[model samples]
Target: MNKLRLIEMIFFLFCSLLSASQKPNILFIIADDLKASVLGTYGDKVCKTPNIDKLAEQSLVFDRAYCQGVVCGPSRTSFMHSRYRGSMGTNLAEHFKNNGWYTARVGKIYHMRVPYDIINGTDGQDIASSWTERFNSSGREAHTPGDYECLNLNIFTDKLEHRESTKMPNRMFVSVSYEGDGSDQPDYKSASKTIALLNEHKDKPFFIATGLVRPHYPNVAPEQYFTPYPWEKIKLPTIPENDLSDIPNLGKSKIMNTNNSIGKYIDNQKKMWSAYYATVQFMDEQVGRILDELERLGLKENTAIVFLSDHGYHLGEHGFWQKENLHEEVTRVPLMVYLPGIKAGRTSSITELVDIYPSLTELLGIETPQEVQGKSFLPLFEQKNKTIRTEALSLLTNGKGYSIRTKDNTYMRYKDNSEELYDMNKDPKQFNNLAKNPEYSQLLKNLRSQLDLRLKQEAVTIPQKIKKVMIYT
Candidate 1:
């Protein structure tokens, strides 16, 4: 062997040994349908999230973290892969597992259909390569004996009425205040199981991802959780008449929303808000439970903690009931990281969820793949004002193309060649669509060009069935 090659091999061996001994444990916590605006640390006055607020105090909070996809499945898949929808690569957990690290998943890490998947106690889309071990937290969603209320139908009963069919039950709105200590809920079980796993794998270098599902659907929580949030005290967001007039058909949700109802949203608006807040509070408490266990085990100092949501939710913003839109309410997610050596800080710099995998690898001094598209923004922890990217791109589901968000404006384009442009500074609510106006024609063209360039650069992920192979027959 050459002298230079021998020296390189020695150095590589040194790094591998050093990393094996010194790398800290990774604790990744993700939430479902959690919007950035609703958290107490993120400036919500009414919602109670004391545990998450405490973590935020000791973490580096990203104020403008956007998700790549708006819905649960696509959004989770995009971030975990550190790539766009059309692009695929090894997932974050799988990457660590490949590096001789003990990685595990304790809940909804990958796509799990809400309520349905929980009811079945199975997640079919989960990538097995991502974990050394995995577990699911199951619960009887709406069927659990409780104080059930179909607010839209003006039906209030301790038990769900017989008229509600078994098929697609609780697919729409159903708020249930159950009689329990909240231990039976899926999120609580997940927290408890995570605590158990920490005890089991405390000695090894581990990458543990616990995805907590709450504030996502059915709005079910313990009766005690509901006590804090009163219906009379809840304040609903302002909904202007004909709010969907300016929005193109592609911008609206074609599928059914969990909160969508025929009418009578007026009388139940306050109750709906109260129920949603209760679910969030319940979710926050589970986080506290996990945090307490971590600190008790003396692993807090050496554990790097990350908290994020798959995507943001719409609480009646722009007359939108749920996610699947490209608006700020749907795309902007809550993101925070707590590393042991770095001092906690917050930044307003634009970031995407896909950047998370790259950032973690960079911070840990690990070698990352060249195919990964996300830019490492660990430097943002040191310099809060620095921006790694000018715009964040998010994919819209159905046939609706995509949306790109910048500091000043948001540009959205549909598959049908239609567009919607909003001047974010003037109309933060996004009630007015300025794409038709001739005054902003130049600005629209520039954004369109940017989107076009991004699409051209991205490698497509076509099915392998059609790929050509040598004719062996």
Candidate 2:
């Protein structure tokens, strides 16, 4: 080879190595039971979430992001694998670890039932092979102060005889605001640990995921968070009389019937709403602290940050207190992605949690596993107006009930042959069910066909038993 030709080749090789080494790190932050409508950027008039709102300003906010499952375990398992739950055993962090990046998890990345898992510091269905290192936050928040009282039950710091367990049905509708500094909270600890990890891994390409477990249950937060949302200012969701009359049997089955008694008391309802909002703001503070640390470390410009919830939450919406429904309140979550150098704004294009995997892989130039069922939405980053999928699907009741959300409507089908259809544009609150109307029969038929096709395309196959006779030979 000539001297000039060899030197040119060497220069190109060095540039390629430099570019590969400078790949951006990924910081994934997920919240538990956080709905999209409660944030300041999502048209929330009451909640004060300045830090989260700032992040939203610099992120490509997905206005219609839906989860694959209505509950935690299924929704998290679905998105982590980039496929429907039970489709294939794939771990998102493990995938990144297998590639060149170092992966770590802090707090509840998987399905850890709050208060139970947090109290015991248990590894609830966590993918062991996914993380290079993992930490669970165990703090005073898990063990409640004894003096707190709710309409349903009382939490005694010291275990009391005859006092009901915190998991009682009636307790789900109550919220407790602790009076003290939040330094001892598990979420606070998780944020501290995440910041340390970021500082430690700042020089290397790392994938650090932090999960905040608040606003999920036991609706407890620091007193400061609750001060902003006074009971007088709390607005209860408007529920029409006989709201459940038109709902199908399958749809009604998911509703928490036990909370109906608590819902009757208007003051109790307002207090519960206030508590939920307070907890959300507390969680947002932790998010801000972590983001601030990332910026302080000078890694903000090169790091790709993704913020989302495992699934949405319900606070008296549809007369429901918690998740486990196929309704929009429980299925649609807040999702935001901030990529360096990309124009930040909002996009109404419907997106799914499963789409997260392929989008990240494509953005980082990593090879995605063949088992992933979601399509890459990286195109939406460049062209905010583009539509990736026509509908977002969510499974409920072990796949017995399913919901399909399109641009203009939401259609739900139950295993018992009952159905529900809503025109989102006309009735955003989903107050009026249009399924039984004769005028919408054709539209319902088309939606059902589309839902069936989508489900078939995303179905996961169960493994069959192997024959024993052939092994003997």
Q: Tell me the spans in candidate 1 whose CA falls farther than 4 Å from its real position.
A: 1-20, 160-170, 255-262, 459-473
Put down candidate 2 lDDT per residue, 246-270, tens digits, no spaces. 8887776343434366545667667
Q: Which stretches of candidate 2 lie over 4 Å from their true place?
A: 1-20, 152-167, 253-259, 460-473
lDDT score, residue 55, model 2?
A: 94
Q: Which candidate number maximizes TM-score?
A: 2
Model 2 sits at a Cα RMSD from the real structure of 6.9
RMSD of each: 6.2, 6.9
lDDT score for candidate 1 against the true structure: 0.79
- Among all windows of ten consecutive residues in candidate 2, which has the lowest summed lDDT? 464-473
TM-score of 2: 0.91
